[model samples]
Target: MSRPGSPVCTPDWLALREPADHTARACDLADRLADRLGAWPGARDVVVRDLGCGTGSMGRWLAPRLARPQRWVLQDRDADLARRAAAATPVPATAVVGDLADLDTLAGTDVLVCSALLDLLTAPDVERLARLCADAGCAALLTLSVTGAVALDPVDPLDDDVTAAFDAHQRRDGLLGPDAPDVAAAAFARHGYAVHRGPSPWRLGPADAALAEEWLRGRVDAACAQEPALVGSAERFLARRLDALGAGGLHAEVGHADLLALPGTVR
Candidate 1:
């Protein structure tokens, strides 16, 4: 999947949406993870490796809830983003700048985590990640993978059309996109992980006008790109949506899923 908070990813976009992301994430999954780890008979300093960690938002949200003495490895392909992520991390962290294709190098890690990343990966890419995590016997907390379900208040006739086009665009070039969550869950299950899933939908309203506006624009643009014939209707639809947003009559629910996968007891 694509990296949202990494160097190739715009920091401003990530920063602008960070609060909403924090607000929308499945906190219960984190609690469930904490409880699972707590029940481990040999609890010790936990090691967490965040893949594609953009500005350390994952760490910021997960660290406090996890037990103390946690060491984080904030990994990204972008050095600048990695450095920034390290600087903002609340726990001790080592920032690694390298290819995400090399994730298998993180063998023996306790937990593997990522946010807004799985949707960019192809099925095989996710399979490889699952195999690596399974080999390491690590728990995984993967969050914010879009599920292709979005609701817009004051819905327009073209809303479903644009959304469908956008979902198709996301799956372009064989990327799993919104299908990643299900595919990854199955992959983890096949590898002997007990998987749990939770919904983490973004509820955007008038208070989030700026983010909502930008998000709407991107959605419309992607739809247009996916189906060039939709350009005319897309423009009209975007205008209506923006107008409703400005008038405080717009609300949106963007669907995302959080997954927790814990390796089963070793024989």
Candidate 2:
């Protein structure tokens, strides 16, 4: 569900950061996923479902790295996004526009994957997801869930305030926000899934000035929205941050985590 102040994650935004997402993701986790899939019985092909599949970036990045002849289901609530995603996918992919909670749609899928999606979910929502995956006996690779830590070179005094507020805004409607990785790990663990986590932070530098600026703008906007009192300080901080970025004196590490959960053998 789209939050009130949450960024809409448009096709443009997804396209712009697709490379960064791919670069930041943990390749070792993907290898681990391949190893787990190798253990699955039978010679049948794999059914991979990408939830909240904005522009199908996840599929584009993950498909070629794994075994071939895979079927990809690009699922999203937005029809336009789903269509564009399906079109951009390198492999044979079908677009399904529906809620992620619809477990029937996920039935028969070997792996359920999502990117930048877990943090937007509430505790109950995440629990339901974990339960569904567990019941279906599918592995899950949920990537890019924010960790609520931002390290910026030439830091400003208001950095912490803005980050804290942005995180608050993320968790506004009971969403897990920065705490999602841990929460999801626990949820999957409760269902007997072995969860592995690794850092997948975005390291933005001078070459990524545009992306860095846009990201900073979003952070500042979210912070001001969460705490109106931070408006004045936010403006100043943003100005300084942007100036430093333009001069190649700014670098940022936006924290995120990649999670791979393998469901235990269903008794």
- Model 2, TM vs. native: 0.95
**RMSD to native for every prediction?**
2.1, 2.2
Off by over 4 Å in 1: 1-6, 41-43
Clashing pairs in 2: none
lDDT of 1 by residue, 93-151 (tens): 99988655866555758889999999988999999999988888899999999999999
TM-score of 1: 0.95
Candidate 1: the clashing residue pairs are: 1-120, 1-121, 2-120
What is the C-alpha local distance difference test score of candidate 2?
A: 0.87
Model 1 error, position 216 (Å) = 0.5
Cα lDDT listed for each candidate: 0.89, 0.87
